[model samples]
Target: MQRPATTPLSDTAQATGITVTNLTKTFNTDSGLVTAVDNVSLHVPEGSFFTIVGPSGCGKTTILRMLAGLETPTSGTINVSTGSDKPVTNSMVFQGDSLFPWMNVWDNAAYGLKMRNAAKATIREQVGHYLNKTGLTKFAKAYPHQLSGGMRQRVSIARAFANDPDVFYMDEPFSALDEQNKTILQEELLRTWEESRKTVVFITHSVDEAVILGDEVMIMTARPGRVKKVIEVPFERPRSVLELRRQPEYGEIVYDIWASLKDEVVGAAL
Candidate 1:
């Protein structure tokens, strides 16, 4: 079937970044070779907050791993521009905070910079900046066990941002939080993105989250994932989580994505 045409962003508003061509990934299982992603092709404009949403085990994480160069693709290419004078950095935030038990929050956030051999002065400044931005400055000296789950996740986000990555890949980072914490993190994430304007590829199962957070939402098929649809969110920038959710157009976009995925979701159940 012919996919719907993507709504083009204006040149002035477009982000300049990466393109994926005929991306496919498969894994060798005991039973047989299992295809996780199939011919998935998409472009993520520079500095745009793009998201991919699908059911569990639909290759969302597989795509992210490939982008991070953690996994090689069976066939396909991801083209990233190296035009920036500064080195390009990529950071990921997984479902768990992945903070070290022995390290305090400040230390954890500085780990990435430390790995890069950044100057002690630079590390201190960057760590302090992001911790303050994520509102975790007070808890900087606290260990992971000392903070709440939400605060731990905030540290994770702070760590990622501290590195000043070119692209940020988040896989269901807020899925574990309660409703209130999730909402707060959502707002914090937007604020971070606004200030940094890094290219982001987020994977989630929540349709509402996709609509609220994405510049474009790429909906995938049940398994052997493909780009079933790409829905643009034309709402004004710096949107509030509550206000955008209440918009009629937001509901329309959510329902449209649902209509496209309902059949695939049902098929997966069978």
Candidate 2:
């Protein structure tokens, strides 16, 4: 049984975390009605990183949007109690650059707080803190147009983190970067997650990325997505990406995920 919202959650309940029960979503296109998601459910523990990997058009992003409350589910419940007195706050980082082209990095990073009517001093402090953490302090004055793709994404990450959301929904935020840049950002993200310990639900098609960052990796099927499997990642925290793949179990885990994913990947392509 669940406790009332006002009641404090037990340590076990707090660790039980974000729950998505029987979630479904559908869309109307010119072709016909489409069911993007189908009765999907998940429980992502608080302060743990959860990753979902699937074939293209498999509704991974749709599931993420539903969790973020950006899309209305056809039918389902998403319970995201933070187990804290403060209301749950959620933030999302998109696949492509989402920064305002006209705003400087600092202004863009401060936008969330400004919208919430946070005091100027509070906005200044939080923005400064995240920008420094993301290694963007030097570029704070630059506009989106002036920075490279990877740099622009850093600003978006800073903005999301500075908002200090209780849960983060990331839709392949590092997918656009080159291998070098992606590796760097992935390392930095691990550092941030280690320090902040915020709950994250991340969607990616990259098996390697999913395994490296997720506490648990969920594999979804082709369109009308459903969970194929959920594999617990046992690698200890403060992980080194450079050394991650070298671990003996790393290849085994990645291979298993891919084996489960192969048919769906081919099906999506057809």
Candidate 3:
């Protein structure tokens, strides 16, 4: 199968990461002006998994939407460049299941390719590959309504992976699953990421999940969020989420995140 090349990675993109500078977003609700994100800056290394952890309603998702070009930043810049004119393809996996109810799993996974006018052979090959990776091959004929929450989420992941986006924006993609299902999906995600080395920006409330998946974890403040700090995950790659929990460094890092997170959690409540 021919590798689809929507956006060729230039020398700059391969070396540089995503840069968000002084990014801010505001919304006017019936209650008046509300600032969701304030001066949130991030530098996510290219091909690295970056996770953002913060309290609920802390504008974590807002930041991701902005990066994905779904939301406009009120005052700031997002430079996802390699200092070149080359383009890059990106896709988003939302918090809730974003499957097409009218389409079966196979079609939903292949939808992006179809939109791109990719060859049928390419769509079949790519969709088949990701479905098998996510353990959805057996249920390829199943509709989203016929599947469980975890199964639907798997279809979503498969869809995103099949699209072969250069940059992936994920907002709590695994938050809906049970422990067993979440663990399985996490491992599957890591394996796929290791193979493709695509840049990923994942948003999760679980500090454990953030640490387990991220090469660097960005902690955000309470409401009108800003960057609290970015902590590098010291563990080597090919990480086992189950085993990493037992490691001393993993424990310390998880503790450190909570130590910073607790105050924000409390402050948000007040």
Candidate 4:
């Protein structure tokens, strides 16, 4: 994740990911300086999917928010590799509904492209491709209110991919879904990602999810969050999420991560 300083996307167009050094965030609460993240340094390689798992309030969302430019770090530097000069345009999908209520499926999916003033033809190609990939082609004119929870998330996924950002920040995007829908969406996400291989930083509470989707899983300590460990998931993709879960090794990895995370979770509650 940290070979060199970030060059312009023009220089390294396909390169994506982040190099965070001593990243810290503190909130000036009435109680005092509440440090959320503390001197956390880690690398997320371009084209790799890295997932972070930590106890509640362990700064998982804070890190994602920082990467998405929604929050400012108290200290340290985050170098995000944009595939282009448009770093401001990087895509993010959140745990809740982030879609525009007024926009139909097609429009919502194409919203990013439209905002960037992409050519109509290019918009059509990208939106159509992603919508179809997400099984939303039949619902092109459907509004957010017309969709189910899973369907709405699919639209969010479609929109994120249609935008084709250099890096993607996803914070528990499927966390609200039932197991069945979550499973389906995870598979869909993997299929699309298999094709694009875009850099993604995902945060989840589920150990299984972190292992299933991430090439490397980062375990974070409780508040004043720091990297506890970065464990490699050696399973090769394009993966079958359910089938992969059935693997003996899969159970072992999930159990191992849980073993490490359980301690932090306890500490957080204390």
Which residue pairs collide, candidate 4? Answer: none
List model 2 lDDT by residue over 164-258, tens digit each. 88899999999889999999999999998788999999999999999999999999999989989999999999999999989989999999999
Assess every candidate by TM-score. Answer: 0.92, 0.94, 0.93, 0.92
Worst 10 residues of 3 by lDDT: 1-10
List candidate 4 segments past 4 Å from native.
1-16, 82-89
Clashing pairs in 3: none
Which runs in model 1 stand beyond 4 Å of their true positions? 1-15, 85-87
Ranking by TM-score: 2, 3, 4, 1
lDDT scores in order:
0.87, 0.89, 0.88, 0.89
TM-score of 3: 0.93
Candidate 4 lDDT trough over 10 residues, lowest sum: 1-10
RMSD of 1: 5.5
Which runs in model 2 stand beyond 4 Å of their true positions? 1-16
Candidate 1: global Cα-lDDT?
0.87
Model 1: per-residue Cα lDDT over 23-123, one tens digit each: 89899999999999999999988888999999788899999988877788898877554344454568999877689989999999998999999999999
Backbone clash numbers for all candidates listed: 1, 0, 0, 0
Better of 2 and 3 by lDDT: 2
Against the true structure, whose TM-score is highest? 2
